[model samples]
Target: MKVADFHYERPDSLAKALVLLSRDDADVQALAGGQSLMPMMNFRLAQPDTLVDLNALEELRGIREAANHIEIGAMTRYAMLEASDLVRKHIPLFSIALPHIAHSAIRNRGTIGGSAALADPAAEMPALLIALNATITAVSTSGERKIAAKDFFLGLYETALDEGELIKSISVPKALIENRFGFYELTRRHGDYAMAGVAIAAQHMAPLTGLRIVFFGVSDRPLDVTAIAETLEGQSATDTDIVEAACRAIGNQSLHGDLNADAATKTHLAQVVLRRALRGMNA
Candidate 1:
């Protein structure tokens, strides 16, 4: 089906893009990789009056390691992150999760910021950000602001971005620099959205100091089980303890029953995956 006609604008600078998006009548849609948006547009799911292409904006592309955090430009593609040795060394979660995102062809063009802004519950980037406690920076004509990943994602396919506001970059804090990270997802086939997904980052202190567990494809947004982390405190994360925490996290979750598995089966799978992730971390 052919989508309704729309005008596309490739602004060379952030200031120009902001001005175009700021207009109330513009009905602007920000274009990044166009991996997700293009399909939706083709299916008529989106009917924007104007497209603000950020491809030419030099401000939106690169990876930088700061004193206390890793800064990734909004338009940096998944392929770039996957290929960057720096990202693999510093933020291994990105490397671990990137391979599971769609396919290589999609990854070649899919931007990290675009994926995060799209806010797909099953996407790897969002889950990783949650597990890593990263912060997102957004900009608009008015000003720029920073938002914690926890606060940024409001619900399914939703973010805290307001009208005219575009994601500028993401800041992943380096507090747990040597933390063990694990990302695993169960999908019907390669590149398909996961039926059940898990992202975990835990510091292996003698007492088990910090643990972050996030699950997607089981809720409107990536579910963070901070309470479970608290429950596992001072306890060595044995298989039994991991199983208990996984069970608690998935006990009453709202996972959809799809062709891959039923809700009951998914709950069981969640426990298994969680245990696997914890064991991977422990190893």
Candidate 2:
């Protein structure tokens, strides 16, 4: 089906866009790259009455470096990120996840903010954000607020973003010298959504302290599995018995099934991904 008829407003300034979004009489939505939104709209998944085009907003279009973190504008495209030296140097794990997002055309048209805002349970960005302990900046007519990535995703295709507020940027802390990361996902094909995936981060080698295990395409949102991390704290990579016990905990969690895979299959795949990711970690 074609998208429902909607009013389009191409606001040159963010202030104007915010004003358009703040209107209470009709459903208002912000349009960035429109990669996801357009498809969703076309399928009747989204039926906004008015669309505030933010493509012209210069404030939402660049990657900047801070002393402690990298700030990426909401409108930054995946292709740009794939080519960014800063991203490759600082967030090497992101480099691993980027190539799996979709095809080159989708990557060229999809914005990081759009992916985060859409909050698809299977999307790589949300899970990576949580693994990196990133922050999202949200702006609106009322004011601006920062949300931790862990606290931002509320449920499947849902987020903590309030009405009329738009994602402004994302902030990710720079990886330290001792930091180590491992990312793995199982897809039917190269660019298909994963049946299950894992993103792992560790502080150092011998101790394996500050371990973060984030899983996607397995639950309502990215499952951090903090319990497993707590259990693995200070454990070396060779602790197979303890790792197996921790992985068994994954089987106990509630999982949602998709068309091609059942909950049990996804649970098994998730376990495999966790183990694979852990094995790939240096310590």
Candidate 3:
């Protein structure tokens, strides 16, 4: 199937874009880096009445360190994030996950906003943002609002964005001196979507002060294991003991699997990736 016929408009400014989007008569979709959107359109999975191109909105591009957080514009590409010194310095977790997001071509064209808005459960950005305790800035004709990453993802291909509202930027707290991070993903190939992946952040070791572990590709959305992670604190368990406890934490998560693996297989792989992530922590 081919993309259905749709009217296209390229607004010169964000205001014009917002005004174009506010038209209730048409089913409007914003086009950024079109990595996923274009494919969906090609597959007839997405058929909008109008396409509003946002590429010219320079307001939504770049990475900068601000006060205690790093603000990354929504249109910023994965390659741009990988190349930015500010991103590496303030949010190294972003760096760690960049290499796993498809290939260099996709990275060069895929925008952060597009990834987050797509909200693909197997994608890395949503889970990484939640793991880092990031906040997303959404803009609309009414005004701008901030939504915590944890609250932004509703389910598969769903988000907290209201009608006509689009993600403008994301803010992640700068990594503190004591913060430690862990990231691991299992895939059939280097750039394939994860079979089971995890992104974790902890305050410190020795006693293990704090932990936030978000799992992806094993569920419909990025799964936050905060309650499960809290169990790690103040425990004097060996690596094997820790791994077992974490697996047990899986309990009844209602995991989903594709043609390559069943739910039970995904559960096992999730455990393997989670173990590797926790055991391979670096600040």
Candidate 4:
């Protein structure tokens, strides 16, 4: 199906884009890579009266190392992240997971910001960001605000982004030597959306250290099992310990399922993925 008629605006600057988005006179949607939005529009799942194209906004398109964090522009494509030394050095988890995002064609056009902003429960970026404790920067005519990854995702296709706010960039702390990371996802095909997934980032420091275990595709939003992390804190993190923690962490929560799998099946898959991720810390 073809998309319905809509007015299109290509903003050369972020300020211009923000202004275009803030106009309450029409239903405006921001367009990044157009990987997700285009399909939605084509199927009439999303019928925006206007589309504020962000491709021309150069400010939102690069990777840089800040004082203690790496700032990735919202428009940075998956292919860029997959090949970036800066990303591999600063956020190794991106390196491990980007290849699993989708096929080459999709990765070539999909933007990190688009994935996070869309807040698809089955996407990898949201869960990875939550595990890494990253921050999402959003901008608008009012001002700029930084939302923690944990607080950024509100629910399915929902986020803390106020109407007219555009995600500018995402910031992640530089990877540390003591940090161990793991990522796993279950999909019928290499490019298919994951049925269930898990991302784990653990700091094995001497004191005040713990891990963040985030699950996606099994809940309304990325589920952070901090309690599970706490349970494994200061333990040997052996296979048995990881399995036990996995069960204890997800055993009580109510996980939702779809035609792909039942709730019980998703929960079991979550446990399997979580265990593999935790074990990957030692790999």
Candidate 5:
């Protein structure tokens, strides 16, 4: 079915977009690449009265390197991130996960902010951000607020974004530039959403300490298993401790059943992916 009739507005500036969103009658939806939104609209799942297209607002579309972090514009496309030297050099986990987002055509049009706002539990970007401890900045009439990845996602298909707020920028820490990273997922096919997955970014030390293991497609939001890091510290990831800790870490999470897999199946796959990720990072 076609989407219900709607009005489209392309604002020249973000301030204008905010003004448009502030009106109660407007029901404006921010349009970035329209990869996810368009399909929903076509299926009659989403019918916004006004679509506030942000593409013409050039200010929200590039990448910058700060002294301590890499600031990526929210509107930057997945394809751009896949080929970005800065992203490869700094946020390697992000680069690793980019290929898992739908397909080339979708990646070419899907923006980072769009994916984050969509908050699909199986999507790679959200899990990668949580694994890297990234922070997102939101702009609205109430002023700007910085939200950590852990607090950014609220639940399935939901986030902390308030009305009239647009994700302006995301700041990713530069400290993990040289970190050893591994991303693994079990999808029915390539480009399909993960049935269960893991993104691991760990600091390679003499004894191999400072690890961050994050799980997706297994919970309400991205699950960061920092306790797994502590358990793996000062020990070889090849050891049995890593495997046991990985299992225990995931066992604590209350996974939900879905069309892709049941909760029990996901819990098993989560263990397998976790072990695979830890080995990949160590190897």
Candidate 6:
């Protein structure tokens, strides 16, 4: 099916895009890479009256190093991130997850900002960002705001973005020498959406200091096991300790189930992935 008729406007500046999106007379949506939005529009799942094309906004198209963080412009494509030496060096988890995001064709057009904004429960970017304790920057007519990744995603397809706000960039802290990152996902096919996935960032100081275990594809939003993280933090993580933490972290929570897998099956997969991710930290 083809998308319904809509007014298209290519905004050369982010300010112009925000102004266009602020109009309340019509349903306004920003177009970044058009990977997810285009498919939704074509399937009639989304019917925006106006599309504010942001492709021409040069301000939202680069990856750079900030003071102590790596800033990725909202329009940066997955293929660019996959090949970026800066990303590979500073944000190794992104490098690990990028190859698993669909295929090369989709990666050519899929933007990190789009994936984060969509807040798809099955997407790898959101979970990875959460694991990294990243921050999402959004701009609007009123002002700009930096939202922690933990608070950025409200639910599936829902975020902290207000009506007129657009994602400007994402900021991830630079990995320290002691920081260890791990990512794993289970999918039927190489490019298919994950059935269950986990991303971990831990600091192996004398004792594991910062331990973040984020799970995706089994919840409405990325699930951060804070209690379990606290349990492992400031302690020597042994094989038995990691296994027990994985079970305690996921055993009580309710996970989502789909035609592909039941809730019980997804929970089991979550445990498997979490165990692998934790063990990878020691490797």
TM-score of each: 0.94, 0.95, 0.96, 0.96, 0.94, 0.97
- Residue pairs clashing in model 6 are none
Please give, for residues 40-70, the per-residue lDDT of candidate 6 as tens digits.
Answer: 9999999999999988988998899987899
RMSD of 6: 1.2
TM-score of 4: 0.96
Residue-wise C-alpha lDDT for candidate 5, range 2-53, written one tens digit per residue? 7788999999998998888777766789988998898899998989999989
Off by over 4 Å in 3: 236-238
Model 1 sits at a Cα RMSD from the real structure of 1.7
lDDT: the better of candidates 5 and 6: 6
lDDT of 4 by residue, 15-47 (tens): 889999999988999999899899999999999
> Worst 10-residue stretch by lDDT in candidate 2?
237-246
Model 2 bad stretches (over 4 Å): 237-242
Clashing pairs in 4: none
lDDT of each: 0.84, 0.86, 0.88, 0.89, 0.84, 0.88
User: Which regions in candidate 6 have their CA more than 4 angstroms from the true location?
Assistant: none
Which stretches of model 1 miss by more than 4 angstroms?
175-177, 258-260
Q: Candidate 5: which stretches are off by over 4 Å?
A: 175-178, 234-239
lDDT, candidate 5, at 155: 88
Model 2 per-residue lDDT tens digits across residues 177-254 = 899888889999998888899887777656667877788998889988756666667867453643575576676678
**In model 6, which range of ten residues has the least summed lDDT?**
202-211
TM-score of 3: 0.96
Please write out the lDDT profile of model 3 over residues 130-189, one tens digit for every residue: 999999999999999999999999999999999999899999999998888889999999
Best by TM-score: 6
